[model samples]
Target: MTAPNLSANLLVELFVEELPPKALKKLGDAFATTLANSLKNAGLAPSTAAVTAYASPRRLAAHVTDVAAVAADKPVVQKLMPVAVGLDATGNATPALLKKLAALGADAAAVASLRRENDGKAEVLFYDSLAKGATLAEGLQKAIEAALAALPIPKVMTYQLADGWSSVNFVRPAHALLALHGNEVVPVSVLGLNSGRQTHGHRFEAAVDPVIIANADSYPETLLRNGSVIASFAERKAEIARQLAAAAAQAGADLKPIEDDALLDEVTALVERPNVLIGQFEEEFLAVPQECLILTMKANQKYFPLLDTAGTLTNKFLVVSNIRPEDASAVIGGNERVVRPRLADAKFFFDQDRKKSLESRLPGLAKVVYHNKLGTQGERVQRVAAIARAIADELGGGELTKQAEQAALLAKADLLTDMVGEFPELQGIMGRYYAQHDGLPAEVADAIEDHYKPRFAGDSLPRSRVGVVVALADKLETLAGMFGIGQIPTGDKDPFALRRHALGVIRMLAENDLALPLDRLLNGVFAQFTGVDGFQANPAALSAFIYERLAGNLREQGYSAQEVDAVVSQQPQRLGDIPKRLAAVRAFSALPEAAALAAANKRVGNILKKIEGTVEARVDPALFVEAAETALHAALVEVVPQADAAFDTGDYTQSLTALAALRAPVDAFFDGVMVNADDPALRANRQGLLAKLHAAMNKVADISRLQ
Candidate 1:
């Protein structure tokens, strides 16, 4: 069959064994993009060509419209040697020029028509020709090879081809390769397989063994009609979601399948033709914690457990089966049977874990090494308890400290439980369950779970004051211990998740509006590691690391970098004050006088930094020689108290606003007075006055940072 011109579309499919469910969509997208890009780059497809990617369990495919059978030829340019070297002394073609021309498929006869242009330093000969474009067959072959090479295959299988002697490596063993331009089969071969217009679909349900693709444009419809498969990954996923919702609604209006994009993507990859089925297990399995039941069902069986309106896991679940039968009871029954054992195991682990009180499991932690240099989990627990108590005492000294200490002691006890051992993601969650079963107070039980609060970005903070205190202490201990042992995170290599830990601490302190000082918390955590060998406290460095995380977090929250820097650069002891400080700086920045004042503050800071000794804010009125200096001192006398009073009461916006009144006098002083006077006493007095001004303006935030 003769290939059609640019009007016809192209279809390419690689039918194979089941691909990695998690990686199938990515592979499909990459394949289509890479292939389309290669074709476009080779001039075989227009830049506006429409590309559609398809992925099913057994196949990956792409259909591109507006593709060409053969690309249009284009001009080509070659930079030959410089003119002086190409031509002889008599301007004849030299041997070097002829040989170079010959290498480029040109001959001596073409030299007379060669064009010369100055290439900056020398005149160079240029050869121009119309280069023949690649045909569809040639471009398709190269594009397929390039696309396969660029796939992000998590793992590859090496298997013998049909020839038995040849082997091919791919994500899965390939069964067929299909390529078509219009109705014509494009002659492209890969992995020992030649291109054809036939591919298999739905191993069990297909009407035909080898589904024949009618044309490039009708592939999806033909596959669905004859092969019983949905070719598009997104379409299949959406269909699954729709079916799941329908099934859930059929059971009850309040019943809904758990929503997880990752699980949906994975299930979409596992099936070629999805049939949503409802399944159920014995209600006795509901005795297990819902998290454990949900985890087992989702992780082991790829089932979507249903949740009630209260978000409590129900005995019912949804299964996305690859087959659709007239009677789905058999399929539903089989899935129910398959998930029962997993639920039973979860129940067993939960029952066995509850038999022993959480406190009884505490001793088992001593056998579990938390870190090589940091000693056992038991020791870490003790340190965390001490830090928690100290922080709680600072927050308030009564029952809060007692609950925090209790919660910290039992936080890691769940690590020894069978349920947590099998599912590490449920460590804190299981700890809360076990703690409550052991008759611990609800506050302590919640804290046991919440000590890992704000675990990931956007995660919620602890729900109670006890949870907050313990969470802060836990994160602080981790940051201090890691930084103390010089296990600081560098570049992308934060294996210990120290950056997350730091951000957690920042979030709790700032978001919770805790009264705890960051430096003191760092010191307390470091103090806990005193007797450990090879441990050196670097609270300063750790403090800086935490502040950097806080700055980044604030900036991510839509605060300007200057606003964040102004507040973060002060190294505010109490992180709770940072929001107020940032708000104050932002407000100050909008005032017309703010720029001049900030500049004056920056200048004053630079002058003060140049001196060897500290410039105390102890100024002498008698030494104010310049009228401008006298005016500035008087302005400070009026503004400083108002600013300090507003600052002391947490009215940061008012405090910064008060400083705006000094902008004119400060500018006048800088413009009219020389701080570096001939007399050292006058210079010292002037520096002292400037220091007072700096102290007043920076009470809320370092205004100089705004500059």
Candidate 2:
């Protein structure tokens, strides 16, 4: 072990081909451990050494600060047992040894122990250690080289070394090896680059190499001074952002950087000394829709979209190119030329979409298949329309009924249009545009557009009640039809995105305060599929499927996973009702008197749970024995109407509040009364009271489920 006061640090930088960000951190950790462990395993430990690994798109480096001038001498080594295991086991070694000797035709003289025998037992494993006063330069080189060669090398290159340059692979060719100890270059070689006192900077902007580096401490500053590309990921990112903002100002607009960090990081890689360029397109392309233009720039060409002060799309755009252009006019011209064809295609699609009314396209959807189990998009639209009509009646029809019908009929029509088929995301939006173009009512157009909303979790819900009803109707049919045909979602495989559709339905109802029963609507949606398409409906199975999904949807909305499970278990009713009930139950559970109330409910549930026969749960007040049982029965009688009214009014807090009334009576009854009495009538009377208690708590949800 070295003295505790050693101070010379060993800094090894592998300026090899560029590396992926993920690999850089891993290589650094591995290098540091290898440096420390290689020394530690040899019974040698250095004082105050830290291996810090940071990466850019280009290089992987490990810097050990406060390392000893020399490595600890003790070395970690692997001693091998040359003999085979089959020969070494048992006392029959003589015969087994002879066989192995003859098989390899190798003499026994040089055959080392194939395993180490600590305490006279065989161990094929080797013990590695570090020795004190070892060579720092040797250990650093070996560690860096071994770690590099061990992992699947990336972005590799070869160089001429007094011979022909051979083909090697890396993110980039290893440029130079720079290992330093206190401003002195440590002579080492890796990936064909010998350790040097200098390094290169920016490739095109400042292609300086062999620029002397004082030490690892001076790396960042030296690169900037010598016109070299400094290996700094954060620095590169900030520079890109700065250049992008400046270019936006130059173009007389505020540029909106796509807020995806991963995308930004990827764009950073293809540049060095980024030169931001501002360009503009013809205002006529604006007729092609903002989506088309933005996508054409951001997704297709990696250009940034720019907007005016009022957040309106300006004709201007910003782009980051790798190097500066002497004549920016040529660059601007080239970008404009490349964008013209995309704009032309967009304009052509826009013209084609308006050629025929969206209503005229409704019949064209018949050719498209929904799925092998489900009917075509045309048939699905019909199902949506039917369900929409039913939901409208339930919601108290007005303009909503007509709006719902309009949206449902034209919803899938866009799937038949060339423009929407090319851009599935623009389905509802395009449908609304086309409907308006066809002189449809504004309200109807709004519903049509809003129907496809909340497509993903946390996405906005349908804006109008008509839109909400139509969307629910659409999703319900998919869920029901798919379930009827046995195309139910499985682990990680909701290929139909049934989970999303189901969640969307729940969100729509909850957000809009719609009180429609989930089970009834589900039944209505699937009833059209009875014996049609050769798929039979199992009502229980389909209802249960929806319940599970509803529970999953609620759980996704921050309800406890266990709480969701508890509610579904107790109230397994309509899929839509449970979310409201669960909120009530969860809120009730968190209250001061909740556990006591739940305990009373549990007493009621536990008795009812055991009574399976038709007569077991039937109430008969005539058989009531104890005062506590009678008191609890009377308490539940009062709570039932209040609970029902609360549920009826969608006042979840009120429903849960009324149920808490039975807590005292329930607890008193359980404390004083015996549920299983010696007389059958007395016991039956107690069970009946318990059933009533269960009913009181269950106005909103299954009381048994809450706990």
Candidate 3:
């Protein structure tokens, strides 16, 4: 393939044993980045760069293009080894330099040739610099190796060097190594495999002697036509989607794309010539819960299911296979065998779970650990129930709270059963089955099942208030319990998924329109936490940590990052009060002087922040020399009461609006009077007046936090 109109080029391929779908996808993207960044750091770069990544079960390839042939070369600077002891400031080498040269196995003649500077200090500097327009191949190779070295392959192995060197360790046995600069394979070696122009195609199709990959364009098509596998992930995905629809049409059904991209990526590896064939399951299996059927099809069978007009699932499945089966009977039978076991497992679990009441499962949860330090799952249920009841009563759900109390007590009970334990993902799901079996109200059973959603972004939300309450309570306990032990998600490591939990809380409140203040709720969780070493929780520390979660949560909700910053700037963030505060600030954010107001507040803050000597706030009204100061004082007198009322009533917009009334008077005072005037008494009064204005502005938000 000719060099595809690119300035520079990049190609990277990992030939590994079958890789997990999730890991392969992650590594594919990661490999692209490593290659691009590697080029940048080596004084090498691309005019335009694109990383095309693809992965099958056994191999991953990242191709970067439009890169410079050679990275801009860097100069290697060499400085004479620290003036070789005492040289008496002469131009001759000292005894120390003689000893070092002898020790380094360097010739004395070479050291003598390294002369001193013209200035005559016995030290000289030399630089080995490479100018521009050099080939970037060597630099690119080094970058690739660096990136590959640090890769996070959770499972790795070492392959013995067939070339008689040490074993090469990697995620899988890297069958072959390939790196290309446009059409040329950059010579490098890894895992005892030489880098070259040849790339092997599909094992089933082109398993003979290696095929030559002449260039970039030729590589993919050649692989597709003869190699029989499309190594470009985008191509593989499109083909899968196309075939799925075609097979659905042939089977007289429609396939809806499941909301499981990870599953899609995983299935991609299990196939080369992705051919979707629609198959059928017994219609009676529909009696299983929709979730059980869908999960079984998607998770176990790697099949996509079809639905009827009323939205009930039809007895159809979409089977994506690696190789097309000519007769299709064998493929159909194999898929049925795979799906039948899951369906049977779901059916058996459904039947077995119903033999006992949700309440019966409660006692078993005591044996399950919520945390080694935080009692049992049974204990957690009690805590969640208490919080849920309080929240329900707050929301005027007095009747519902009592029912939710019953549900919360048994919400996690199903966690102890064999089915739920085996399928930990079906926590609330199993609870619903067990609840319904005991003839509890449908609302309660539904709530038990629906409590943990929308489990992910764009996922479904809880329909029942009972579910919402339990969901909130459960998340609250997690945040609290984790925080109590000083375990919060930081960086990319959230061993407990605390960030997800926080986001879930934010979604529950916003999507459900619960509009509950998170302060009181987060505070409640903190209250239940006993710190490490069995120490009672420090209410102060817990409050600070939850504030971080709240700020992060707000930032993700399309709230301006600065708005979250401003709201969090308040020392004691009132969780129950933040939503209203944020709303008020958002409403005022676009007003003619909104940014000015925040700027003014921040300016006032810069003054108040540095109170070297205590300045009393008793502004001497009698000595108000500037007319603007008196005008500002008059506005505060008029606005304080109304602003306070608005703040208390959660009418943040109104509060900010009322505060803005002081802007004109504030501008007038600063325009005429020096805050630090020569007259000590007048300066004191001016500072006090400014402090008063700042105090009034803070009711809505620290305003200084706004942009």
lDDT ranking, best first = 1, 3, 2
Report the lDDT tens digits of candidate 1 across residue range 112-133.
8899999899999999988998
Best by TM-score: 1
Local error of candidate 1 at 106, Å? 2.0
lDDT of 1: 0.91
Q: Which predicted model would earn the best lDDT?
A: 1
Candidate 3 clashes: the total is: 11
Give candidate 1's TM-score: 0.96
Task: Note the Cα lDDT for every prediction shown.
Answer: 0.91, 0.68, 0.72
Q: How accurate is candidate 2 locally (lDDT)?
A: 0.68
Cα lDDT tens digits, model 3, 8-52, are: 456767676777676766777777677677776654665356667
Clashes of each: 0, 34, 11
